[model samples]
Structure formats: C-alpha cells, structure tokens
Target: MRFTDLISYQALLEPSKPAIVAGGKIVTFGMLEHAVRSLSGRIHALGLQPGSLVGLSIEVPSRHVALSLALARCGLVSVPYASAATLSQLPPLALGLSDGGLVVGSAAINLVVTDEWFAPSEQPVPDVAIADDADCRVFMSSGTTGTPKPIFQSFGGMDAQAQVVANHHLLAGRVSRILCAMPLKSAWGYRSTIAALANGIAVYFAAGTADIPMTLAAYGCEYLICSVYQLQELVRLQSETMIPLPSLAAVCTGGSLVPAELVRSAQSLLCSRIILIYGSSEVGHSALEVAGMHPWQDGATGFVTPWTEMEAIAEDGRVLPRGETGELRVRSFAQARFGGQPAPDGELPWFYPGDRGSISPDGRLTISGRTVDILNIGGTKLSSERIEHALKRHPMVIDAGVMGVADRQGLTEVRAAVTVRGAVAEAELRSFVATSFPVAAPQMIKIVAAIPRGDTGKILREELRALLN
Candidate 1:
C-alpha cells in the first residue's frame, strides 16, 4: 500500500523507462528510485523521523517530486508550499534546506549545505513504515476567499486516488507521455503526476507556455493537463504561432469556469478534445466532461465520475431531488480529511465544496455559483455569478468577477473587474448588467489585464478584493 512501492515495482519491471522529462533531461525509473533513496537518507540526517511534518519548497519539478517520494519512503508528512514566498508566510520552519544552502532555525541549530545536499547517497535510511490511516501529505487550500486551510490526506486515501485514476480509463492506455502545464505544488498537478507515474507514463514538465511547443515537438506527448488560465495561454500561443500539436490527443483542464468558446478553440487548435473536470481538493475527480463527444451545456460542468457520489442538499440538511439547485455535497472514496479529523466509520461524511449546483436526472451537473460568492447588496442577496455572467455576455468581455465592498455606513457596494478580448468600455459593461438587473447594477467596473487565479484556475477573490480596494 506504500506509495514508494509503486515506483519500486515500476523500476523492477521497467528500469530504463523514462519517468520524468524536464529541462532537456530524462529521468528513468531506476534513477528516480535511487534519487528517492538518496534524498530519504538526507532527510533522515536532518533528524526528521516518521510522521514529522516537513516543509518542502523545491522549485525544480523533478526535485520536488523526488523529495515528495523520499518523504513518503521515510513515512514523513510533507507540506508542500507553492513557492518559497508562500513558505515564508507560514510559521517559520524549525529548519530548512535548499540548493542555495541557506539554513535557518528557531533557537540553536543552523547549518548550511551546498549543492552537495542534492547529491545521491547510497547510505541506507531506516524505513519508517506508514500505517494506512496515517497522514502523509497535507495540501494547502487555494486561499481564494480567506486564509488557506490545511487539507490532510492519509496513506490509504492517496493510494485510493491513484487506483481510481488508474481505472478511470480516460488516459488508461492511450497516454504514454503527459505535459504538465501547471505547478507541481497544486493539487491538480500533483494528482495528475502521481496518476501518470502510477500507470508508468512519462511526464514532461514544461517550464511555461513558451516551452510547450518545443516540448511537444521534441518529445511527443499524448496528454496535457493544466488550469483554465494555462489553457488560455496555450491557445493564445498556438493562435499566434499557428503551430498545432498533432501528437496531442487530449487536454484536461480544471480550476475555473471553462468558457464554451475556449473549449471549442482548444479542441480545434490545441487538441482534439478537452476534458473539463469539476471537483475540489477535498473531493477528487467528482465529474468530468469529454468535450469532443458531448455538446456543450451553458452552465454544466459535466457528468459525475464513476467513483463519486454527489447530491444537492438544502440548508436544512435535506437532500434535494435531482434537477434542484442547492449546495453540492460529494462523497468519494478518495476524499481527503480537513483539519486532520477522520470521519467515523459507517458514516463517511459528505464533503461540501461550497458550490451551489444541481444534478440532472441523467447525472449532468451544472454549477450556478459558489455559496461564498454571493453578494449582499443593499437588502438583497445577489448572486455575483449572475452579474459576472451578464458581463461576460458582452462580445468583448472574456471574463468577469463581482464582489461586494462594505462602507463605513454598513452599506454594500457592488464592484466588478473584467478581462476583455478587445477594448470594452466600462459604461457599456455596466449598462449591459443593468439590462439584466437594473437595481443591482455594479457601482464600478474596471477592466483588468487578467483575473487573479490560483494554479488550479479558481479565482483569488481575496486578491481581487484587494485590487478593488
């Protein structure tokens, strides 16, 4: 049931198979296994034992992955920060190590190690066996609305997700290599990488959208995964260069609302089809839509995946019938525990992703908006999603977000930020929204270069609000 066991099995079966491709280098399974063991020994020398929480801030995708496996090999818990900046915001780690050799500690211990810290060591590190229920990884929330919460995943949960992904059949045997267009620290990126490795598929970590063409041309990749933002960038790049990735079979995207136009563009230019996934870090792979096979629905995210059970529950805890819009609750075998509290046996708790959506009789899910995204304007509770939708209806507006700002008089003011494909006047956008809801028209509309989003494509409302302020 160990995560490393999967790699070990792959190494034994196909030692020379390429596992990771990054920065013009290919790392085989044999090399990956050796690096994991070497890094595990280094971690052990740092006085970190099994179950100890280690802060990982590696920038290199290969090293980040290697360190993650090393931590799992030693049965230590890993808390990966998206960047070093994020690492500094949290409670300072007791000790830290990087390629730069900067070592800092709280009270006494501080030692600097050079690039030798990354050198492989044959020294055997004690294998601290991990229990199935023990927490092995903690994922930080995207912090779109507030402070990021720690979402904990047990060893069993991780293994279950890998198996679920392996059996999902979307990339089963069709995908030999995948290009990751998102940061490895993100839940989506990490899950995709692990699933690919678990299936013995090679992963290419593209530096950015600029590197996508080169990577695809040099090394053929069948699958691509990224957030909506990265997908947009890729499409933009392709449109400008007029280069098509004929080797790419499918592109899977998540993290924000996928516009029908973007999906169509991606299908025509980037790949043959687009797979839009709908889920949160708490509930993995709740639903997905294969765009090539299905017609696009205005607000539909997709059909529920095989391994997920979803329901729309009213505020009173009543489960609504299908086709009724309410708060979405998802129950998946691969669901993670928040705040480190496991649900009681025989009563697996349903995960509330804060999305207000409905399930059709045929199992299609359409999300109207998020419960937290509702705005209290004057005396009425207005759906910001509705306003954003109105703005996006304009031919020039590509994306929009609305937020309520409170003044000293306890009055709420509606403000909007929008990204446009062409020049769009704020008055025109405001007038367009006024045509929909004249009374709840936005007080102010500002055109921006881009919408603030996390790696997964979720809007960073906190940052958006900051910009509005």
Candidate 2:
C-alpha cells in the first residue's frame, strides 16, 4: 500500500484522534486529511505531473507532515530539503541529486508557494493513482563529507520500512503519544514520525533542543525519538533539575555510537528503557539493543534485526566466522536509492555499509568503527571508536572524538578532542584515557567547547582535523 493511503485509512478508522501536535496546536486525523487534500488540490492545479520532483523547505512540523503526505498522494516525489539552508545552496544540491523539477516553500526560490496556496479550499481533491514501485520520496544525506546526496525510496519500500520501525520500537498500539527531537528533514526523524502516524499514534514536535524535556512533559508523551547527542543533553538537564517525565516509557537513540555511560546515566535519571539503534540512511535499522536485556560491551550494537541479513567480511573478501572483527555488510529488501537508483555501486548482491564490526554466534552485532576512521599508528591499526569510548568513560567528559594526525615526519599519532561538562586538565584527561586503554592511548588531547558533528551526530573528522592545523 502507498504511504499516503495509510493516512486516509487512519482518518477513516479514527477521524477524531489526534494526529499531530505542533506549535501548541493539535491537529486531529480528520483535520490532517482535509489539509492534505486541500494542499494537494492546489499542487495539482499547478500542472505538476506524476514522478515530478517537488522540493519542500518548510520548518513547521505540522505543515511539513501534511505537505509530504499531499505530495505522495498526488504521485509526486517529495524531497524535503534542509530548512536552514539558503536558496542558493539548495538549487545546486537539488539539481545534482534529484530531478529538480520544482521548489515549494516560504523562501524566495523558484516555483515558490505562498501562504494562500495552502489556504483551505472548497474544491474536491482528486485521487491520483500511484504505482507501488514508483518513487515517492527523496531524502537528503547528512552531508558530512561534502554535498548532501538525494536518497530515493518507493512507496512500497517506505511503507514496509515504516512498519518495521514501528514494530521494532513498540510504537504500534502501546505508544499513544511521541515527541520527535531531531530535525524533521533527517531520515530518522521523518521515518519515525511517519511510522508513529501510520500506527495511529500522535506525534509532538519540539520547538527546539532546549525545549524537548518540557515538550515531552507538557504533551505527556510516552516515547521519544532523539539522537544520541540529544539524549545526552536531556540526561544532563534532568540530572541538574531533576525534571520528571511522568509518561515517558521508552527513549530510542541512534545516528551514532551511544556511550554506555550515557545510556546508564539516562536510564537511571529518566527511569526509562534506553534502546540503542545502529543503522544508516542506506539501511533502515540493522541492529537494536535494549537496556538491561543485554550486556553493553565495546562496539556492541545488540541483536541484528530480523528483516536484514548482516555479515562480517575479512580483507580478502572472505566471510569471517563469528567473533572475528571485519567490515560489516548488509542485505535488505528495503535498501535506499541514490539518484533514483539502487546504491552501493556495481552488481554486488550485498551493500557494504563501510562499518567495521563483528557478529556473535548468538546473533549480536558489534560495530567497531567506520572503515575510513581507523587509524594506523606506526603500522599498528587501532579503531577510533575504541579510543573515543575510552575518553567518554571519564566522568568530566561529555563527548569525545579521536582521529589520526600526521606530524612533520609523516608519522601518524592519535589526537583527541573532547567536550567536557566542567574544567578538567588535559594531562588528567589524557592520563585517564591511558589508564583505561593503555594500548591505544592518545598522544595529545584538546578540550574544546564542542565536537563538530553532522546533523545525525556523526563526527566530522575533517572539521576536527582542521582544529589541529
């Protein structure tokens, strides 16, 4: 079934049920259907055809959600661009990644739409038939390396992925209300919000990061979808003020490696189960870990999800046996599209995620680090994830990033940058890391205000390297 059809079905089943809560206004399913239909009629009047690429730069969560569903119902591929990006920055990125047929938003861009376009209309919205395999949405990558690339997915794939995420997070019938703390344009944010909506759950969008805890408490949300960094901030806030989220039961965190210490601290203060998810934009979710259900070990990502096939391969292209570390590869029925086409280059059956990891005989997946982030010091290879994990163990450290830097002699040494909650001596921090992991101690450590990160919380290694220069 098309993802848009799910909204109509929900409206039919529970029209009066709350579908979205944004900007202190509640929109019921009935109102959502009407708004989508009204906006869709306006879009159709513009003469845009099926499969046409429509760019969306709306910042309001309610409007973004409605317009996305409307674009899908009209059989148009909706590409949600970064709301904070400039018009000049968007066109080139959209042209290189998507078909770039039209742009729609409050910005003064080409084919711009005004407030009147989304005003309530009396015209009946026509039902546009859409093929199951037709591309329905284009999501931009986090753009950590360079320009963000457009990732496409079919209607059927999106529906299937939404179901998988909903089922995995227990959002179907158990969760009545959820708060999304990430940007609506992010893959995780968009997918998790739609998944909740598809399962007949109400979603609350926070005004900003600082307001997440208050939003959750005000809305009495039962679940929260946030990045690891956001979770860390929430934990810090809760610890300082002892704020109570009376209804919050589960907190799902992903987009980067979550420190075990952070998870333990959050679980203690919030009294909520911490679910760590490991996956990428290319693959929806490959592994999941629930607090107290499994032992949190270095690089452990918990059990692999049932929908995807995961394996570890050695340098010689040989699939390694369980308990051995190697490059992680995944094969799933719901793979993402690049430039409106399937990704991973070549005709290989499996998609290499470029993550170094290992799978246990019991089926638990442990992600060691990214292939590109591995550091070679005097021919001794070390995983950057391990060093970062060690640095994070310090009580004063809030976040840490480790990378290789070459010196005058072209010899690589491990350098670390960290964000701390309080004043801490660099020598003391380095000494702590050395004691924690003597074999992989960093040669130098710099205390910074914050580590540069992408939207999804992945460290920008190039940006961190620039600090050293």
Candidate 3:
C-alpha cells in the first residue's frame, strides 16, 4: 500500500492524533485527510489530469507536505525543489505550487483555496486507479558534480521505502515525534515525513537552524533527523550553553562522514547517541553506524542492512571479494538508476553510488571516498577521504578537503585545503600526513576560510578545487 493508504488507515483508527506540528499548530490525522482531499479537488478543478506533473516550491513545510499528499492522492506526480527560483521555469501545465497559488512563469493561476484547503469539499476528486508500478515522484540528486539529475520513483518503490523506514528498530515505541531539520525538498526529509505520518508519528519541521532546540523542548521530541554538519553545530551550541535535552534519545545523521572526534564530542556534551547512516537518493539506506554500539573507525559507515545488498567491484566490472577496496554498488527495492534507463539484457542493475570502498567478512562497509574524488598520484590511486581524515587528525585542523593537481611535467600530485581552528604552518600540516602516505604526501597545503559543501554535507570537490585554484 502507498503512504496515503496508511494515512487513511491512521485517520480511521486515530483521527485526533496529531500528524503534523508546525509553528505551534497541530494538524490531526482527520484534519490532514480532509485537507488532502480538498486540495486534490482544487487541483483537479484546474483542468489538470491525473498523471500530470506538478512542481512544489512552497516555503511552508506543512503546506508542502499537504500538497504533496494531495498530488499523490489524485494520481499526479510531484517534483519538489529546494529553491523557489526553480519554480519559474517549469513546463506548461506543470505549474509550481507556492504558498499563494499555482506559479507558471512569473504568473499566478490563482486557484485559490478557502481556509487553506482544509475545509471538507463536495467537489469530486478524480477517482483514478493507481497501479503499483506507476510513476509517482521525481527526486533530484544532490548535484555535487554539476546539474542535478532527475530520478524517477514508482509507487511500489515508495511503498517499499516507507515500509522499511516504519519498521526500523530505531524508530520503534515511544518515538512518537521527531524534529526533521532537513528541508522537505530533500529526499530524506520528504520520505521520512511521509513514513512517519503513515505510521502515526508526529513530525515537527524546524523553521530554521536556530529553531531546533526550542521546537524539540516544546514538543518533547525523542528523535532528531539531521545532517552531520548540523549535529556538529548542535553539539558546539550545547557545549557553550551546557543545556540538557532530557527528551532527546538519539540523532540520526547522514549525507557525510561523521568524524570520530565529533561523535565523542556529541556524546559528552549532548547526552545523545549519534546514528550515522550511509545511503543515497537512488537507494534508501545501505548501512548505518550507531554510536555507543559500534567501535569508531576512520571511514567506517557500518554494517549492511538486511533489506539491501552491498558489494565492491573492480574497474573491469568483476565483483571484488571482501576486504578488497573497489567501487561500491548497492541493490535495494527502492533503488533507481541515474537517468531512468533500464538495465541492458533485462538484468537487475546494481546502482553504483560512485563510492570507492570495501565490505568486510562480517558485512561492514567502509567508504574511502567518491570514485571521482580519487587522487591519481603518479598512477597510484589514493582516496581523498583517507587523506582528509588524516589531515583532520591534527589538533588545529577543523576540516579538510584534498584534490589532485597536475604539475609542470603533467604528473599529478596531492594538494589540500583546510579550515583550522587556530594558526597552523603549512609545512607542519604537510608533515602530519607524511607518515600516512610517505610517497604521495600533499605537495601543497592551503588554509581556507571554509570548505564548500552541499546541503547534505557532501564536500563539493569542484567548488573546493576552484577555491584552491
């Protein structure tokens, strides 16, 4: 069943239960259901047919969620974007849903909704039959490389992902509310919010980074969903104030590597465990590292989940054995290819997440770095993640990004850019990594104000290279 089906079930069982809490307002399951139906009718009245594509750029999280469900309920595909400016160029009839009305190329359709589309509507929504394999959503990639790629997802795939999320042990019992700090436009945020609502959990969307603490305390939220950077910032904030969050049980983080030092700082200061998940927009979740339960390793992501398949492969496409580092591939029911292309020969395609790493005999996964980010130093490949982690081990270094630059002889050499907490000599930092690489130590080190990062905390290699240049 789809997430909307689950919501309908929850509405019947517990109509009064709060499904969404935002800006001090609560929308119960019953209210949510009515709003979805009313909004569906409102959209259908616009002459938009079932299976039409719609873009959502609403700034309000609650409105975004409601409109998304409305789209799904009436068999329309929704493409949600983080930037409101993106809404200006959508295809005809594929209008962007804003807080005010439908936006089409700087013009508003004025499909106005009374009472914010919460009132019950006698207007009939299209009774379109939805097939499991029908296209439902288009998720945009993080775009660290360049332009974001559109990944199409089917209803069955979404259902599988939602079920996987709802049944995960970490979200079980008494974990009724969560503060989703990530924007709903992100795959993580939208999927998690829908999954929570389907399973009768309340979702609180933080207005901004500054609103996290107040919302968590006010709602007594037991769980927090955020990125690795946000967790670090929160830990720093808690360290300064020494305030306690008695309700917080854990922080689920992903989108980037969680440093061992940062994890320790969080434990000591925040009184909460950090759960580092490894996944992509194409694949839901591959592995997870839970603080306090697993030993800290430099690039350890964690063990593979039961629902997913993980393996390493060589350049020739042969699957590598455990302990042999190579490109990483993942297989899951929720996975989609880069461009909606089906695998050749009708074979089940394994999604190459562009990560270079290996799995141990016990099924643990360690991500070394992005496949594209690998440094070709004199024909010997090196993982930038490994180099960056080594540089970060220095006391003064706060963060680091490594790249390969060509010299006068056209030979590639290692180079690094770092953000430090205090003064550090370039030679001193170079010496720090000499012991680890000896042969391919960074020939040049540059101090930078900050490293460029995407929304989810992935280092923007292209941007970092530009900064270093």
Q: What's the alpha carbon RMSD for model 3?
A: 3.3
Ranking by TM-score: 2, 3, 1
Question: In terms of TM-score, which candidate is stronger, 2 or 3?
Answer: 2
For residues 1-469, write the lDDT of model 2, one tens digit per residue.
Answer: 6667787889899999999998899999988888888988877776666877666767677787988898888787777765434333433322111123334443333454555656788766868888767887777776655456666778877888898888866822278998888777777888888888887889898877678888888889888888877887788788888768888898888766667787889888875588878887777788887867876686677788888888999999899999899988886777676533254665425767678889999899887778887787767777787788788878898888898877899987888999888989988877887886665677888888889887667777778888755
lDDT of 1 at 1: 59
**TM-score result, candidate 2:** 0.89
Error of 1 at 415 (Å): 1.9
Per-residue lDDT, model 3, residue 281, is 88
List candidate 3 segments past 4 Å from native. 82-93, 100-116, 169-173, 340-346, 377-381, 386-400, 413-450
For model 2, the stretches where C-alpha displacement exceeds 4 angstroms are 83-114, 171-173, 339-349, 378-380
Clashing residue pairs in candidate 3 (N, C-alpha, C atoms within 3 angstroms): none
lDDT score, candidate 3, position 113? 32
For model 1, how does the per-residue alpha-carbon lDDT over 215-334 read when each residue is reduced to its tens digit?
A: 887798888887876787677678779765778887888765677777888877877677877877777788887875666676678899878899998999899999998988888878
